[model samples]
Target: MVDFTPVPALCGGLLIGAGASLLLLGIGRIAGVCGIVGSLLDAPRSPDAGWRTAFIVGLAFSGLVGFALAPASVTNVANSPPALVGAGLLVGYGARLANGCTSGHAVCGIGRGSTRSIVATCTFMLTAGVTVFLVRHVVGR
Candidate 1:
């Protein structure tokens, strides 16, 4: 019943893991998007702001390059601008509340064997399942 394409998924996971490993090994930093972007926005004059800015811009540029390289890989998921904006706001709020996003908890923190990250990762999975259930069944969407 799994609807996912495992090869692509695995490849993406490996890339993410490699990226995280490189960040950790090279600069002793966690490759958490929320934290990186947050630090850039919250403290533009911080000593590490240059790196953070470069990281964020590199992310955006990578996406743009990917889209240009494979337009088929970029499918519109039927989301409006406002809906996307609201989702971004919610994600930012959640990141602040949890002190990190899924990448930080599931990848870096869990890799470090942090108890808090494990719990947060589990919570993220549970919440995702519940949201899907409600969306597909309860809300009839």
Candidate 2:
């Protein structure tokens, strides 16, 4: 069984909130990772794109820093690497097709009192739950 501690979860939530707040205050941008990554790939149009690129780069490096500094703090799940990579790609494609990711739709969108976002988030949750059930129980993974 996987054990999850609330302390780290709360800290992660705090950091996410801080990042979103800073993005909103400092750059007048939403701290959506998908949007940030997409904007960074294009030729610079908005003057704010530079900072967005930096923020995205820093976010990427933070994962490396966490693993390096606290290797034992992380858990590794046993799975086929190819299967995981394919699943990740499919999820990314789905998120892009859906116009936003869980962070954008669930966190920032719902926070702004958007009815569409609320519906989207609920749909996302339902679909995720169904998929997990099918994969774990129905498929006997």
- Residues 52-88, candidate 2, lDDT per residue (tens digit)? 7788788879878988999886678787999799878
The number of the candidate with the highest lDDT is: 1
lDDT of 1: 0.89
| Global local distance difference test of model 2 | 0.79
Model 1 CA deviation exceeding 4 Å by range: 1-3
Q: List, residue by residue over 24-54, the lDDT tens digit for candidate 1.
A: 9989999988999887888999999988888
lDDT of 1 at 116: 96
- After superposition on all CA atoms, what RMSD does each candidate show versus the true structure? 1.7, 2.3
